[model samples]
Target: MGRNTRKRRTPLATKIVAGAAALAVGGGGLVWANFYASAHEEHGGHNRTRSAAAQVATIDCPDVGQQIRDVPDRARGEVDGELATMDSQITDAYQRLATTRRAQAGDAQFVGNSILGPLKERRKVIIDRIQLEINRAGGRADDNLDELAGCQGRPADQMQNGGGQNGDGGDQNGGDGQNGGGGQNDDGQNGGGQNQDDNGNGVAGPVADDFIDINDVQPNSRNSRNGLAANGDGGSTGTFTTECGVNENNLFNSDNLIAAPGVDNGAHHTHDYVGNQDNDAFSSDQDLAAADTSCQNQGDKSTYYWPVLRLQDGTQEFDAGDQGGGAEGNIGKILKPAQAEIKFVGSRQGDVVAMPKFLRVITGDAKSFTNGDANANSSWSCSGFEDRQVTDKYPLCPEGSQVLRTINFQSCWDGQNIDSANHRDHMAFVQEDGSCANGFQAVPQLQIRLAYDIPAPTVENGQVQNPYAVDSFPEQLHKPITDHNDFINVMDEDLMNEVVDCINRGEDCQ
Candidate 1:
């Protein structure tokens, strides 16, 4: 299990079709219809009552990070720590809920009384600490934060019914419900309650309904004008492709520097990291700038990471018995991506600006399962069937077609700050008319195209044989909708300017 010695798999050639908009000049301006709006929210918020014997699928807690928008810079560290503590509290409560199924079976209110109630109490204490720290730093704290302390127990059906779903599912920081909505089975996939057992998979989620055949899916893709004109021309038409190795170095960690900086296991799930070699919760900007990179060009030392994908074939990996791994219900063997393509394109509206060094950008919501798809920007599709993209369910790729995970980062910047209080406000996606809002400048948009040579899991009889899922917070239930990616721009100044220049001039550069 040496870091660089992991077995490498060859990838088959696959066309690239990602994000809300198609790449204008880098790859051909291939149009794409997205699945952010209606596909996943079909059964969400129907308010069906669960039977008394219904099983609680997972613990549903308010996203504390989403609610706190005014944390002072001086108090961000402590508030972040408290938020990390609340996440750990939820993880602990979820573990208790998952393991004590028998006890829950006997007591009708067992989940509410033992798991959710205790979780809420702990969250209240952490919420108080967050508000206190903010106020101590001379910032006005939200007086109604106590409302976010209460947690709920969602049954499998409720989870299947995702809450507060909206069109486009691209609200980066704009969902209101504590438990937004649940997964659905609109395509005749399994939508029943959880199994009494773990269904032979050590993890708690990704039930049969979590997957659908790509061929069975209708072509719901539409051409999006991400920053491009309706004719798919004009604007910054160039692209800069960076050759970052598919994290063959086994650079993995559970800490999230952007959200829960300085906290151990902040993500509560392992992430596959490429680009920057020295990344952790405690890594400073100085540390990242001096770190070695996995990219072919030493000047482009940006950090790119995402939750590790695992195949549930009963193979125990390195973190199997550790926290953020099997202990938190993320089991199975981690799968390395067959190909990792990192490309940066310009805005279609006008010339693009260089991203400031050390700028942090996060795309897709890791908590999309409970937070709703308002901010769900990631998409899943098969190699050949690129026209069919799914936001909620994993694609059951046909034979010879690879599984692809596509993510397009927020392309518009607020111009003033490199980081925002919510880690999202500083960045925005392009509007429908392919223009950035007032005061926001268009920046080079990073798009990730990752392909995996995974064996399509056999789904039949409401059971999965070898399911593959992304690492996620335990409560997120390993749903495909919860898949997300993270990035920190550590590129040197010269290379970044070159990226901007090449993009503005409409030339493809590497």
Candidate 2:
């Protein structure tokens, strides 16, 4: 054996194979034993499982670059509707103030009234509100907008960990959890939605079921009519009318007539209603389809009463624009102080000028003009040879001149009337006789009708109750015109421009 020791040893390759086989069998037996023990332990009221820490694997190669890209851009914006409403209100206030100063000359029914009026009080309130809005806008002017998802600084849906993002972000197993680890946060939540970036603007929410078309709105209206839906659309029982007293027979002939903003048919009366002032002008346009143009048949009255329409660019302005009933041959236009300025002209005594005195301007009454009629009495003028004075007859324009249908009551001759000596006063009748019970009295402008013509009151014992001055005119008007004693005049370029700016900006100026 010693002589052949190398040969006697087992072959090297053969020995290695035998050892591998034995090792495999031994490992298999151990694995089986372990499985059996675990199963038996569970059945015997004893169990062991991997810890949560053991289950969660460390996310390697987390793709940090792609994860960062998941964030949204900065988001925020302002709500335009609220801004517009406020702007309109502000503009209205400016216009009202200017109108009051000019129309009412800043005077009042009495001293107390001058201090407290709708325009004055409302204007103050609007100013305060505008200031608050401006301050709020300042905070959001430069904030990151991409994040804001709702009105104010709120988000549409809030995320765990105080951010708008949610889900266990790339925590483990490539789960659906985007941007974070999965599972709801253990703490209570505010449900605040998402945080808005800078600029009060946020992600838009779903609009309400009701919305209106703005283009279809009439001028001076907050209401809209377009986009209305009904159970059906086809035939309807409806009627419409305009300020000029339109009828169904004239539907075809009426110009500028259009569909009304809406129709509100009552049980007894069926008619169309316009929400806006400008839209109201077209109320009867549809109804006029059955009629013919009759303005041409009325002589020179075919044209406008004031010739104020646009005709400069080779435009055609004809009698067809007489839907307003030819302005009733008595136009009454009111321009607020913001639109036009009024100045007084006085007489001159020597080199120095002497201002004339006017009591107050009268307006709103139906003034008539009878231009071309002849009557008795002869002072023998070459044209008609009659003693008729200008005032006695409806005043006429000069020969071949057009009569002015509307006149702005700018200045005044005080509250006095020329009733020949025995003629009872006519100016005072409107105020005293109570004729205008249902009538509109030009409530927009500062106004005055004649003093009441009732018989002089009898004062008993110590005092007369009316407290009105006997001479009729008050001391306030007796002095020459000035800011304190005159009407508040706001008609100027600056004020008008301000109003226009606010309106264009879509602010709540009202």
Candidate 3:
């Protein structure tokens, strides 16, 4: 998912007008008149006093600052505690709403009436209580407290319009909300539905017809391929060892999973998260190292994640129904992955080494919706059976078979920068022949395989119907198979050392 480079900027005059209208509606005509006069004076190069007055009038809750100041010293702690609790509750509600929004699919009105409506009402009550307390302490409170509370009236549409209620700037439902098109990032890079070179140049690749031949992938001759080690030997051999870690059935949410460093909520879509429980856009090495872990090994604190794949049934899990007023589509409802397997595949010929901490890397392309930009590395197969592969169309799995989505990230690191401008420059995909490129260091390769228990696509009149479509991806994406993966290493030093030693010893440990 990409951030929208073009911002929807509300002009200063428009903001002023909206504020004035809100005031008038609240029977604060005198306040609006005073604000209008002060704004005009400031525009005419009036005194600083007029500018200050204009600024105060623009505050969402005009008297909040004064109310805080006027609170009696004896009750200040209690007020602070209540305010803190209110903020926490609101944060929790938003998180829950986001989860529900992604888990269930329906029209915007149904979603609003069922999920967002109750949350909004509860928030209103809290806001009213806060306002009453403020007034009781000799402070004026805004009449329209609901607006100040920022409770979303229509969350489904808003989430698709621009990355949900938090305004993370990424489209949760994928592109710009028009035919599931791509959105541009701040660097002029198109996010989702397209592929570009390292320099951001669009390069068209080979297009698959209805389906890709499973024979395209090279074959591996490894057995005992079950549980966490289902994807090849993981760079292990007679004298070299590789360690595997599995994080099973972790909760995946609709929160942003990737953004430029320091940018929070940059991913506008849903992603399954594993390892670090606190992984987010602002996550740092320190933050991740201190976070809780879902992995069996407590010392493995790295964050692993990828976009979610939904079943696309009419049930709540697959339904991105129409928003009220006729906006129809499955925008935010991305199904949680059934399971994820993580492993470190070291070079069979070299000394096993620890992966750099906080190493940021991305695999595949989230924007790869069209044939021109679809990731060559992206692969789809069937669970329990690797011989079956499908591309561009959903595979009609036999009864009892499940779908499998696998992504193998580049194992060669630049040995200097943890990340690059394009998020791919710092790492290079291992050559098809399985050799690291020049100038890149070979570290234990990180590979992720996700499984989903989804039924085969419905067919009518000899044609397959795509009910499990990715709402934010272009229709050309084909059955919503827009797959990508992200990794951030936060393993403790001792644990990394242990992993290195195990790999060097050529032991296959899980």
Candidate 4:
């Protein structure tokens, strides 16, 4: 509600402790072994025998906890303070990368090399120093360094021997690491098998078959078509319309979309962003209010961003911790759609009303990596007047049609809080039958439609290779259908009044 003034703390130690607790409480030795094996392999080290032995024999919970306890409290505090500062620096670097201008061919690379690269190196050094201090205080240095540092050990020297290789020491298809290339199913499709249309055209991809189908899925039960307005008389009728044409001038990639509130770049995965000039972990209300905008309605300084949809060509590259490629070292090369169609549709339940400003809401949970998670609200279809839709995978557009990713946000507001603890409680989706919940007030519903001209995933050597996929950090849990968005209204008072008037009068002014 008020400005966030709390100091930031690094969660590495806590994560390690929680993990150790899980291992202890669950007595899941096999699970721990599997996790260690996975982590070991992810570093690209082949000497799994030695690594596994070291992991099991070198340190146990009692040993680590005692070692941690043995450290002089003052020293531990100093290390934490230093780590927090380093974390802040790293976050700032990523924010810089997200907001930097990418006007030239190599601009993305420059940002990676000049900003993210140095910060990552510095972070490695700090993490190493912390590990050494913990070891000096009687803890095994390697026991939890990876978790504590929030990074895999630097790839073996042999992996880095080739200078021009991608940063994670993986190939163009992403390395064989745990976070890479494992998204495909047995059929080689990303999520599900491709489907053929009635004409026998193999035009449907995993997303279409699994997640959404434009032909079957409706925006809401009441408004099945794209341009149709909401129905009902008890505040179901939309009064005013405003469209913001958001251009992708520059791109943003960061992990800080949902979890970390004020900390910039806190997400473990990368997200592509557009709209507001400043849209990272550190972005504050004041900063957003002051930042320039890419929307045609310059007065509406709202931020709209989502994970980048990557063209899965061999050229895609990933940064550290990113599961798939795209939006890592190459920022500018990722093409932007001609324009993003952002529309606000509100129902006039009562008198003309100006919606609250700075209302924050998130649609489609990014953490819903598993299929059938109630939060998975992603939808995909084809453009160019074609009719096909799918969920959980990319759509196979017909010839001459483009790909479309549509995300719709909840429109019923609690009419009080601008944000809730979960960033969602203040808002609820319109009912499946298209009525606002009883206690919630109907606000302008926000929907975003992104169009891309890309081909469908194809099978190569028994494995489906997608030329395009959604960019995700950390894991290829599902097809890039993990879509989410954010908005902050910065309209002038007069404009707000006009919007309320337009809506109350049942007029659609686009």
Give the Cα lDDT of each candidate.
Answer: 0.70, 0.17, 0.41, 0.43
Better of 1 and 4 by TM-score: 1
Which runs of model 4 end up more than 4 angstroms from their true locations? 1-246, 255-258, 316-335, 348-352, 384-387
Q: Candidate 2 regions off by >4 Å?
A: 1-322, 326-343, 346-364, 367-490, 493-510
Query: Residue-wise lDDT of candidate 3 within 166-189, one digit each (tens)?
Result: 223212221122211111111222
Candidate closest to the true structure, highest TM-score = 1
Can you give the lDDT of residue 216 in candidate 2? 24
User: Model 4 over residues 1-510: C-alpha lDDT tens digits?
Assistant: 011122334443221100111111111110011111111121121111111111110000010111123334334543543444453443334333222222112231343345433544555676577667766765555554333222111211111121211122211221112221111111221121122110111111112222222334333342221222333465535444344444444545453433444443444344555556666555567777888776666666766766666543333233321211222221112445555777666553454245677677777655333211345566677785434445444555566677887777777778787765335666777765555676887666777788876655543222244445554322222344445566666665676667666666666765
For candidate 2, the C-alpha RMSD (Å) to the true structure equals: 41.0
Per-residue lDDT of candidate 1, residues 78-164 (tens digit) = 787787887777777666655554454455555566666666677778888888999999999999787777666565434423433
Candidate 2 has a TM-score of: 0.14
Q: What is the TM-score of each candidate against the true structure?
A: 0.83, 0.14, 0.51, 0.54
lDDT score of residue 349 within candidate 4 = 46
Q: Please name the candidate that would achieve the greatest lDDT relative to the true structure.
A: 1
Question: How much is the lDDT of residue 502 in candidate 4?
Answer: 65
Off by over 4 Å in 1: 2-53, 160-197, 222-231
